[model samples]
Target: MGQVLFYKDLWKEEFWENPWELGGLIVIGLFTVTFLFFILFAVLFGLLFPSEQTENEE
Candidate 1:
Protein backbone atom coordinates (compact mmCIF):
# COMPACT_ATOMS: atom_id res chain seq x y z
CA MET A 1 0.00 0.00 0.00
CA GLY A 2 2.75 2.43 0.90
CA GLN A 3 4.59 1.76 -2.35
CA VAL A 4 1.69 3.02 -4.40
CA LEU A 5 1.98 6.45 -2.81
CA PHE A 6 5.73 6.69 -3.37
CA TYR A 7 7.09 9.06 -6.03
CA LYS A 8 8.76 6.32 -8.10
CA ASP A 9 5.76 3.93 -7.99
CA LEU A 10 4.47 2.92 -11.42
CA TRP A 11 0.93 2.09 -10.27
CA LYS A 12 -1.86 4.59 -9.80
CA GLU A 13 -4.61 4.43 -7.20
CA GLU A 14 -7.28 1.78 -6.81
CA PHE A 15 -10.88 2.80 -7.37
CA TRP A 16 -11.98 2.53 -3.73
CA GLU A 17 -9.34 4.97 -2.48
CA ASN A 18 -11.29 8.07 -3.45
CA PRO A 19 -12.64 9.84 -0.37
CA TRP A 20 -15.40 12.04 -1.79
CA GLU A 21 -17.09 9.64 -4.18
CA LEU A 22 -17.77 6.88 -1.62
CA GLY A 23 -20.15 8.95 0.48
CA GLY A 24 -22.64 9.25 -2.37
CA LEU A 25 -23.45 5.55 -2.26
CA ILE A 26 -24.00 5.62 1.50
CA VAL A 27 -26.22 8.68 1.19
CA ILE A 28 -28.20 7.12 -1.62
CA GLY A 29 -28.68 3.90 0.34
CA LEU A 30 -29.82 5.79 3.39
CA PHE A 31 -32.32 7.82 1.38
CA THR A 32 -33.60 4.72 -0.36
CA VAL A 33 -34.24 2.99 2.97
CA THR A 34 -35.99 6.07 4.30
CA PHE A 35 -38.14 6.30 1.21
CA LEU A 36 -39.07 2.63 1.43
CA PHE A 37 -40.00 2.99 5.09
CA PHE A 38 -42.07 6.06 4.28
CA ILE A 39 -44.00 4.14 1.65
CA LEU A 40 -44.40 1.12 3.92
CA PHE A 41 -45.71 3.17 6.83
CA ALA A 42 -48.03 5.07 4.52
CA VAL A 43 -49.51 1.81 3.35
CA LEU A 44 -49.72 0.33 6.85
CA PHE A 45 -51.36 3.39 8.31
CA GLY A 46 -53.77 3.69 5.40
CA LEU A 47 -54.84 0.10 5.96
CA LEU A 48 -55.06 0.42 9.72
CA PHE A 49 -57.09 3.65 9.70
CA PRO A 50 -59.06 3.00 6.47
CA SER A 51 -59.21 6.81 5.87
CA GLU A 52 -62.97 6.68 5.62
CA GLN A 53 -63.74 9.06 8.41
CA THR A 54 -61.74 10.71 11.10
CA GLU A 55 -63.17 9.44 14.39
CA ASN A 56 -62.34 12.81 15.94
CA GLU A 57 -64.45 14.61 13.29
CA GLU A 58 -67.55 13.91 15.31
Candidate 2:
Protein backbone atom coordinates (compact mmCIF):
# COMPACT_ATOMS: atom_id res chain seq x y z
CA MET A 1 0.00 0.00 0.00
CA GLY A 2 2.80 2.41 0.80
CA GLN A 3 4.49 1.71 -2.51
CA VAL A 4 1.26 2.30 -4.35
CA LEU A 5 0.73 5.64 -2.64
CA PHE A 6 4.27 6.69 -3.41
CA TYR A 7 3.85 5.86 -7.08
CA LYS A 8 0.55 7.71 -7.19
CA ASP A 9 2.13 10.80 -5.69
CA LEU A 10 4.98 10.65 -8.15
CA TRP A 11 2.56 10.37 -11.04
CA LYS A 12 0.59 13.36 -9.77
CA GLU A 13 3.73 15.46 -9.53
CA GLU A 14 4.84 14.49 -13.00
CA PHE A 15 1.44 15.17 -14.50
CA TRP A 16 1.19 18.58 -12.89
CA GLU A 17 4.71 19.52 -13.98
CA ASN A 18 3.56 19.95 -17.61
CA PRO A 19 -0.19 19.73 -17.91
CA TRP A 20 -0.35 21.85 -21.03
CA GLU A 21 1.85 19.55 -23.08
CA LEU A 22 -0.21 16.47 -22.20
CA GLY A 23 -3.49 18.31 -22.67
CA GLY A 24 -2.45 19.64 -26.05
CA LEU A 25 -1.39 16.19 -27.18
CA ILE A 26 -4.70 14.72 -26.00
CA VAL A 27 -6.71 17.42 -27.76
CA ILE A 28 -4.80 17.02 -31.00
CA GLY A 29 -5.22 13.24 -30.88
CA LEU A 30 -8.95 13.60 -30.30
CA PHE A 31 -9.35 15.98 -33.21
CA THR A 32 -7.30 13.77 -35.51
CA VAL A 33 -9.42 10.76 -34.62
CA THR A 34 -12.63 12.72 -35.08
CA PHE A 35 -11.55 14.09 -38.45
CA LEU A 36 -10.54 10.65 -39.63
CA PHE A 37 -13.85 9.19 -38.49
CA PHE A 38 -15.90 11.72 -40.48
CA ILE A 39 -13.64 11.44 -43.49
CA LEU A 40 -13.92 7.65 -43.50
CA PHE A 41 -17.69 7.71 -43.28
CA ALA A 42 -17.97 10.34 -45.98
CA VAL A 43 -15.77 8.38 -48.32
CA LEU A 44 -17.64 5.14 -47.62
CA PHE A 45 -21.01 6.73 -48.35
CA GLY A 46 -19.72 8.53 -51.39
CA LEU A 47 -18.46 5.28 -52.92
CA LEU A 48 -21.21 2.88 -51.78
CA PHE A 49 -23.95 3.65 -54.32
CA PRO A 50 -25.05 6.14 -56.94
CA SER A 51 -28.06 8.40 -56.53
CA GLU A 52 -31.05 7.82 -58.79
CA GLN A 53 -32.38 10.61 -61.02
CA THR A 54 -36.10 11.03 -61.27
CA GLU A 55 -37.89 11.66 -64.57
CA ASN A 56 -39.72 15.00 -64.98
CA GLU A 57 -43.21 15.08 -66.51
CA GLU A 58 -43.98 17.97 -68.88
Candidate 3:
Protein backbone atom coordinates (compact mmCIF):
# COMPACT_ATOMS: atom_id res chain seq x y z
CA MET A 1 0.00 0.00 0.00
CA GLY A 2 1.21 3.52 -0.81
CA GLN A 3 0.65 6.56 1.42
CA VAL A 4 -1.14 9.57 0.00
CA LEU A 5 0.49 13.00 0.32
CA PHE A 6 -1.59 16.16 0.81
CA TYR A 7 1.08 18.67 1.80
CA LYS A 8 2.72 20.91 -0.80
CA ASP A 9 6.10 22.63 -0.76
CA LEU A 10 5.19 26.09 0.48
CA TRP A 11 8.77 27.38 0.12
CA LYS A 12 9.11 26.18 -3.48
CA GLU A 13 9.36 28.78 -6.27
CA GLU A 14 6.56 27.04 -8.12
CA PHE A 15 4.23 27.59 -5.18
CA TRP A 16 4.78 31.36 -5.31
CA GLU A 17 4.52 31.39 -9.11
CA ASN A 18 0.74 30.91 -9.00
CA PRO A 19 -1.01 34.25 -8.63
CA TRP A 20 -4.12 32.64 -7.14
CA GLU A 21 -2.14 30.86 -4.44
CA LEU A 22 -0.12 34.00 -3.65
CA GLY A 23 -3.29 36.06 -3.36
CA GLY A 24 -4.94 33.44 -1.16
CA LEU A 25 -1.88 33.37 1.10
CA ILE A 26 -1.91 37.14 1.42
CA VAL A 27 -5.62 37.14 2.30
CA ILE A 28 -5.15 34.43 4.88
CA GLY A 29 -2.22 36.30 6.46
CA LEU A 30 -4.20 39.52 6.67
CA PHE A 31 -7.21 37.76 8.17
CA THR A 32 -5.05 36.06 10.80
CA VAL A 33 -3.40 39.33 11.81
CA THR A 34 -6.72 41.13 12.02
CA PHE A 35 -8.25 38.36 14.12
CA LEU A 36 -5.29 38.42 16.51
CA PHE A 37 -5.43 42.18 16.77
CA PHE A 38 -9.12 42.14 17.68
CA ILE A 39 -8.54 39.44 20.29
CA LEU A 40 -5.72 41.41 21.89
CA PHE A 41 -7.72 44.60 21.88
CA ALA A 42 -10.67 42.87 23.54
CA VAL A 43 -8.43 41.37 26.21
CA LEU A 44 -6.81 44.72 26.97
CA PHE A 45 -10.14 46.49 27.11
CA GLY A 46 -11.59 43.86 29.43
CA LEU A 47 -8.59 44.12 31.75
CA LEU A 48 -8.63 47.89 31.77
CA PHE A 49 -12.37 48.25 32.34
CA PRO A 50 -13.90 45.21 33.98
CA SER A 51 -17.61 44.82 34.57
CA GLU A 52 -18.97 45.04 38.09
CA GLN A 53 -21.65 42.55 39.09
CA THR A 54 -23.39 42.88 42.40
CA GLU A 55 -24.94 39.85 44.13
CA ASN A 56 -28.13 41.84 44.73
CA GLU A 57 -29.36 41.33 41.17
CA GLU A 58 -29.61 38.05 39.26
Candidate 4:
Protein backbone atom coordinates (compact mmCIF):
# COMPACT_ATOMS: atom_id res chain seq x y z
CA MET A 1 0.00 0.00 0.00
CA GLY A 2 2.78 2.40 0.87
CA GLN A 3 4.63 1.60 -2.35
CA VAL A 4 1.48 2.15 -4.37
CA LEU A 5 0.98 5.57 -2.79
CA PHE A 6 4.59 6.52 -3.44
CA TYR A 7 4.38 5.45 -7.06
CA LYS A 8 1.13 7.35 -7.49
CA ASP A 9 2.71 10.48 -6.08
CA LEU A 10 5.76 10.04 -8.25
CA TRP A 11 3.61 9.65 -11.33
CA LYS A 12 1.60 12.76 -10.54
CA GLU A 13 4.75 14.83 -10.14
CA GLU A 14 6.71 13.33 -13.04
CA PHE A 15 4.18 12.56 -15.75
CA TRP A 16 3.38 16.17 -16.64
CA GLU A 17 6.99 17.31 -16.39
CA ASN A 18 8.10 15.17 -19.32
CA PRO A 19 7.83 16.69 -22.80
CA TRP A 20 7.44 13.35 -24.55
CA GLU A 21 4.65 12.35 -22.20
CA LEU A 22 2.85 15.63 -22.86
CA GLY A 23 3.26 15.30 -26.61
CA GLY A 24 2.11 11.68 -26.56
CA LEU A 25 -0.91 12.66 -24.49
CA ILE A 26 -1.77 15.44 -26.93
CA VAL A 27 -1.47 13.10 -29.91
CA ILE A 28 -3.62 10.49 -28.22
CA GLY A 29 -6.23 13.12 -27.33
CA LEU A 30 -6.40 14.39 -30.90
CA PHE A 31 -6.77 10.91 -32.35
CA THR A 32 -9.46 10.03 -29.83
CA VAL A 33 -11.41 13.21 -30.60
CA THR A 34 -11.09 12.68 -34.34
CA PHE A 35 -12.26 9.09 -34.11
CA LEU A 36 -15.21 10.07 -31.91
CA PHE A 37 -16.15 12.90 -34.26
CA PHE A 38 -16.07 10.55 -37.24
CA ILE A 39 -18.31 8.09 -35.45
CA LEU A 40 -20.72 10.86 -34.42
CA PHE A 41 -20.87 12.30 -37.93
CA ALA A 42 -21.50 8.88 -39.43
CA VAL A 43 -24.30 8.19 -36.96
CA LEU A 44 -25.89 11.60 -37.55
CA PHE A 45 -25.63 11.22 -41.30
CA GLY A 46 -27.20 7.79 -41.19
CA LEU A 47 -30.00 9.07 -38.98
CA LEU A 48 -30.68 12.09 -41.16
CA PHE A 49 -30.57 10.18 -44.45
CA PRO A 50 -31.36 6.54 -44.23
CA SER A 51 -30.87 4.27 -47.23
CA GLU A 52 -33.90 3.14 -49.18
CA GLN A 53 -34.44 -0.59 -49.19
CA THR A 54 -36.92 -2.83 -50.99
CA GLU A 55 -38.01 -6.20 -49.55
CA ASN A 56 -38.09 -7.81 -52.96
CA GLU A 57 -34.47 -6.88 -53.67
CA GLU A 58 -33.25 -9.21 -50.94
Task: Give the TM-scores of the predictions, in the order they appear.
Answer: 0.58, 0.56, 0.66, 0.70
Which pairs clash inside model 3?
none
Once superposed on the true structure, which residue ranges of model 4 sit more than 4 Å away at CA? 1-7, 53-58
lDDT of 2 by residue, 1-58 (tens): 9999999999888886797978987999999999999999999998897566668633
Off by over 4 Å in 2: 1-17, 56-58
lDDT by residue (1-51, candidate 4, tens digit) is 999999999999899999999999999999999999999999999999999
**lDDT at position 46, candidate 2:** 83
Q: Worst 10-residue stretch by lDDT in candidate 2?
A: 49-58
Residue 53 in candidate 3 has what lDDT?
86
Cα lDDT computed for each candidate against the true fold = 0.75, 0.89, 0.85, 0.97
Residue 15 shift from truth in candidate 1, angstroms: 3.2
In candidate 1, position 44 carries an lDDT of 95
Q: How well is each residue in 1-58 modelled by candidate 1, as lDDT tens digits?
A: 6765673343334334666656776889999999999999999998899856687886
Among these predictions, the greatest TM-score belongs to: 4
Q: With candidate 1 superimposed using the best TM-score fit, by how many Å does residue 3's alpha carbon deviate from the native?
A: 20
